[model samples]
Target chain A: MSRRPSPSSSTAVPAARYLIGIDGGGTGTRARLVDSAGRRLGQGEAGPSALGQGVDQAWRNIRQAIDAAFLAAGLTPAAEADCALGLGLAGAEVATRRERFLASAPAYCKLALATDAATTLAGAHAGRPGTIVAVGTGTIGLARHADGRETSANGWGFPVGDEGSGAWLGLLAMQIAQQAFDGRSAAGALARAVWRTAGGSRAELLAWCEHAGQQRYAELAPLVFETEADDTQAAALLAAAAQAIEATVVAIDPRAELPLALCGSLGRRLEPYLDAATRARCVKPAGDAIDGALQLVREQIRQPLAPGIP
Target chain B: MSRRPSPSSSTAVPAARYLIGIDGGGTGTRARLVDSAGRRLGQGEAGPSALGQGVDQAWRNIRQAIDAAFLAAGLTPAAEADCALGLGLAGAEVATRRERFLASAPAYCKLALATDAATTLAGAHAGRPGTIVAVGTGTIGLARHADGRETSANGWGFPVGDEGSGAWLGLLAMQIAQQAFDGRSAAGALARAVWRTAGGSRAELLAWCEHAGQQRYAELAPLVFETEADDTQAAALLAAAAQAIEATVVAIDPRAELPLALCGSLGRRLEPYLDAATRARCVKPAGDAIDGALQLVREQIRQPLAPGIP
Candidate 1:
């Protein structure tokens, strides 16, 4: 049996108004210690700590980041004990992994774990009922209602379905290169640019791509974007990306009444791509994922929703 | 004067003896030396020599490959200078480039440069004269008549077009990835595999893709093929590729009789993606692009075209 550490054993967080919020993403983990009055006392950041990676790694990352924050504030790690904690983690939707994470994370006075998206959505809506569509390394459209109802669409990984994502744009550029190679058509400068951008030769590009262990293909999307005006192929690819995102939003809810918030790297970049028609349909939210995490903690403190939000 | 070597400088070849055919592709240049006996004597390969790349590079690659073939066959490069040469160049259709290549290359007793697809079609029809649709890195449908007339369709470069080519497959795969990322829909294992195959992590993949010296991304298409069955998104992407090719063929001549010879790697690998209806209209060519090149050279030897074939 795994022994659960007793919160009472620690001499941290005697303050009744202590609170904490964490944002665990694919790239890294971040945590902030705040007070009941919404004053931020400490903040921390650490390495890549997505839960899908595994609980041990996630915990370690979060622990390191949180520890840094505490150290910076001239406090002990145990000071987190006085806080009500909220964690918005990537891949928290996977029930089994979530359970494992919840079971293993070091003790806090009170804790809640949810998807990174949820926190992002909460932040964007400032804990109000609204929808948030995020497009980062991938894409996803998520919504939460004032009545606590929720709906989600898309978020398929890269390559096969990232919509207007960088991966999607890069893939389109690849197709252009393939066409150029087949002698069916001329890709003009775009093909040359892509090959040159990847590496000097096809062999080197393939080798580097295999060895890099990064979604390197997605990186090529920027070149396509940069050359769009001069290269029709690039322009068309971008248009297709925009259209794909529009499709996702339409799928989520055809009506424009729902408050739709956009977040994530790609999401921020897609503003120009969004047609006037799509822009008219979505209401911009007020906050970001971080804000949402804080709101969730505050709400939980006010009224805990344990068995789940019905 | 860029040293325009006179075509008349070389010794003439016997009317029914040998022919030289070249397939100038993106990666490198390939030339085949065939005799009237239908035997392949010398096959040479060299670095990128696409006419679009530049006349100097093209000439250098072609000459290297041709020289290698001559060396392998115990013949001097100068000895075959009199043989008629048929060049199927990736960028031969571009008027300016074609003329430049013709002026630059070592003078054969007779020579002609045509679009690479022309060679594929001629070879597929075995020089008899018929419609041949070649689907590979790109897609093109060509109709040839015994009277020497030709009509072509659908080889536009991607992402706007290229129909049923590798470019098309790559483009579709990218769109799917984007769609998946955007939360428009769910993509299966294929997207994941594609992401994994393209360097693993987001940053690594991005770096490898965007680096100016990296290799081309088309080399990674095999990953999609490997995971096609297990990944629905990939299967769909491949299906789109086959459909694009079939569409290109249909656009060529709706009622044309097909003995549609297929070309290109994807043409062979994703054959199953072609529907039965499309397959019935397909043809397997007896010869390859090299044969077509041979036929072109032989024609130049017997009766040079009005000097406009290039």
Candidate 2:
């Protein structure tokens, strides 16, 4: 039986000089490489590594991103034993998959795992106490209190939750497009734009729906923003999404004391739509999730691996 | 090269004494068997036969339902040549799939195909000139005019269209349940019921969403009705559904001159929720889609096969 090398033994190796931070999500996996002093070396990206997709695929994507980062850094790809890895991954909140991922860790000198939300929060606050609402194709709100207590709200996956995310807006847009196609509702500019983009006929719309996944639906989100000014449907959907974002933030930080940051493609766009009080509390994130992942790695290197991590 | 047997030639067979009416939907395929005189012989049900599911699977499910009906009739399962078939199928509105289905017909004596909406209207009006709104797991409205002209509205499939459908209501309920699970929203009676039914935890809900399809979403629709009285979310959903039904009926028959019938599992339940004007036009259906499929077969037996139908 193979036993994990003890942390002290692994750290004794002379070549263990690099730290790799991974931000893995449904859309893509990104890796940032830094040295012992936290100097940024390079960054690279690969396909989605969301744990829900499959453990093998996730690992493959992470490896691909890491290798790219090494290549960009003008260094040969290092063996697992030469690096420490910190992974902030979507779907890592699910215990079974997360456990499988941790248990199957390669021969890295040291490693740590956390949900992408945690990494985003860490990055947003520069590893301090703060709140961040990450709203890209999906939505999640996380807060780290001054005392280090952490809380999260509304990060459910597409077509069900993920309110105020790109998927949420896209879903409402598609429904409006269907109503337009059936003539049950007036075809507003947003609906017309969606229909035009989706092939412009009921049959075409039907075909699109038959094959549509979260990504496909998310592709329609731009039309919602584009037509919001002239389309009541689009405006209503945005308002609802904005309201959800507000609700999410309030749930994560009820006292509104934490420095709040809105992150992701959709997050900044939603800032203008938030209520006065919430908007006043919002701040730009100090760093991205990659920065947070690097911070995570730095923390792990400074301390012993958490109990049972090996 | 093989050619379809001409309708005239196939009709000459003496064994063609039965008519089979098939209502093939996403949830299930149902078959109603009748003698030459239009007297009901038996009914049978099988798995989903929605054309969108794949023609081969749809055909297999339809055949299974027909076989079960034959067995229930206390008759030896007759060869395909002994039966004339009429199919009212969901997803038959897609021209490519419909054509493929028609082109691949088996050795039946004669056959007719129509959208489930058209067949439901036919059955509801009993071959008369009227309109019917079908509100089962999906929703559609069809109107048959006095001059034999027909029109339809809605009936788009789940997650995109199908407004006011069981799937629509259920999707909303699940979203509410997700919000409730995250403590982002209060767990109202409807949300609590859905959570209880879906295994009562965020993990269970996540698992459910991971594997959920249209059928699974439709399964939660009952909870909406079950808790509507005490749940604001349920009441709001039903009201939206009722408004959708009203909009569909108006779209199908704008003048409201035709007698209107509500049909399907959720149809009658929506009656009390309809606007007063739309409710005033509602009538009990004379028969269900099976009866219309039977009528369709009887008409085909009397008239020559329509052009372009092999």
Candidate 3:
């Protein structure tokens, strides 16, 4: 139903000779190339390709990473018709962005698209059933059931959601700073630090708020972690964030059977705050999202096309 | 120290025969006119003039309202030289905005500026000693002591501050709607209503958040009020907002000795939720902020220039 150009039907193309798995995010993009036998040929990295940034930028980064992988493998770069692709990208959950991203894909023989969280989960478990809590500037929990069903929690974005993420912690810090500014609450060290960062004046804070977004707020999270030991407000904020993260994990995989991995910069930091029972079930991830992307492409090549599809 | 132009010194102008008191806010600007004896001459209204919007827009709205007031009074529209001005406008508390606004003042014979909260308090008490809780899209409490000293609580802007304000209610509603979307919370009537208004899709919500501001969030407040009776989340949100309003009032005047008036649309709505002790101390305001503005100008004329002035 999409108006954009579609790749030629599988029957009209030669079988792909190479598989490329891409893990694309807001910070950067990574590519892993594999031969037909599933052996890793090479890996490469490039700048951010977050789908939310825009389809063009995402594709540009994706292409650069793929080319780097080919160069490292010491082989001529594969044409789009010679490769199959598996992409786990940030902002792929939004339907419109996902559609446009798919439509923009090069004429690869086969392709699969999913959210970064999905790839993270697959990577953590090495293509097995497991769960993952990714807590950076945003927070999301993903679980893959034994039956291949998947579920997600949180990851609703900043301000309204992402309760246990960096942005959430920063928001709490800002509120405490405001309360301190108005004398409604005590000006603890954390509050004072944030206030000084805002130029120690209400006017400066106003100006900051006018343009403040998730990245700007996330910059304050480090102060929360630094001051949590001595500042009551900061400690409380961390505790609440940990609780939210725990809730997300429970919501995604209530049964404690599957291996759970805490991923991302803020994810590991929250480990100490999680309850002992939940912490007992946690396991270190077997691989990264880029590994999961490779696994995805391998599966796509084996299946080739869904049943009943010509 | 401001680089902007300063108004001509008060001693250089003739004694003013008319006073114009303007209450400017984000929604609209209102103006009241009075003669030497303090008799009401006329009233007029114009578009929003909140200084946060920009100095040029604020002045444009203020001038329009003043002109409308003169027309209503059936008097030749007085030049700025013929009238002294008193303005209690939103965003006036920020020093930069205050200075810029003062510099942009039309050549009024004399002018005085105060925050809208201060003017609301002054108007509520008719320049006497009293306290007031003003809660519209934002919330602030102000108290004037018998000694002519004044203090304020809250009034921090939206999202980070302004707890118990219209925008606060709207923000809570949005969060609840998001929780419902993620299946983390039940979708009650309020959540359903909000989601429907937002096009009931995650992509649409993401699109909305990209451009959402205080005004956009504040628009959700009406749903909270309408659903509060039957929806648990809505009721809880209102109760919390009321508690915040109560806290602001208590923080401003702990003893509850001063006459207290609850002003603004959201403020009056919170009255039913206030505790018996706090509600008992509440009194109806004698006049609106426009009247308070007139009183401000009247007082300025009586005192003329300050004692140490040129």
Interface RMSD of 1: 8.8
Which candidate, 2 or 3, has the higher TM-score? 2
- The C-alpha TM-scores of every prediction are 0.55, 0.93, 0.85
Candidate 2 lDDT, A220-256, residue by residue in tens: 9999999999998899998998999999988888888
Ranked by lDDT from best down, the candidates are 2, 3, 1
Consecutive 10-residue window with the lowest summed lDDT within model 1 chain B: B206-215
Cα deviation of B72 in candidate 2 (Å)?
A: 2.2
- Judged by DockQ cut-offs, the docking class of candidate 2 is medium
Candidate 2 lDDT, B198-295, residue by residue in tens: 87876888888888877788899999989999998899999999999988888878888999999988999889999999999888899888788878
| Candidate 3 wrongly placed segments (more than 4 Å) | A1-21, A27-48, A60-85, A102-111, A254-257, A305-310, B1-11, B15-18, B70-77, B199-201, B204-210, B254-257, B306-310
Tens digits of per-residue lDDT, candidate 3, A101-214, equal 888888988788888888888889998999999999889989999998887878878677788999888878988887777666678989988987876877787778767777
Model 2 chain B worst lDDT run, 10 consecutive residues:
B5-14
Tens digit of per-residue lDDT, candidate 1, span B85-113: 78888767666677778777675666767
What would the per-residue lDDT of candidate 1 be over residues A1-310, giving only the tens digit for each residue? 6443344433322344567788887788888877679887888899877886788999889878878777766777665567677888887776678889888867566777788888998888777777777877667777776677776766645443456777667766765764554444576667778777766543444344434322566777778867887888888887877787777777666565577777877777776788987776566668666667777776655553323232
* CA-based DockQ, model 2: 0.68
Per-residue lDDT of candidate 3, residues B203-290 (tens digit)? 7877786567788888889999899888988999988988887877777776777988999998898899988988998999999998
lDDT score of residue A162 within candidate 2: 89
| Pairs of colliding residues, candidate 3 | none
What is the full ranking by TM-score, best candidate first? 2, 3, 1
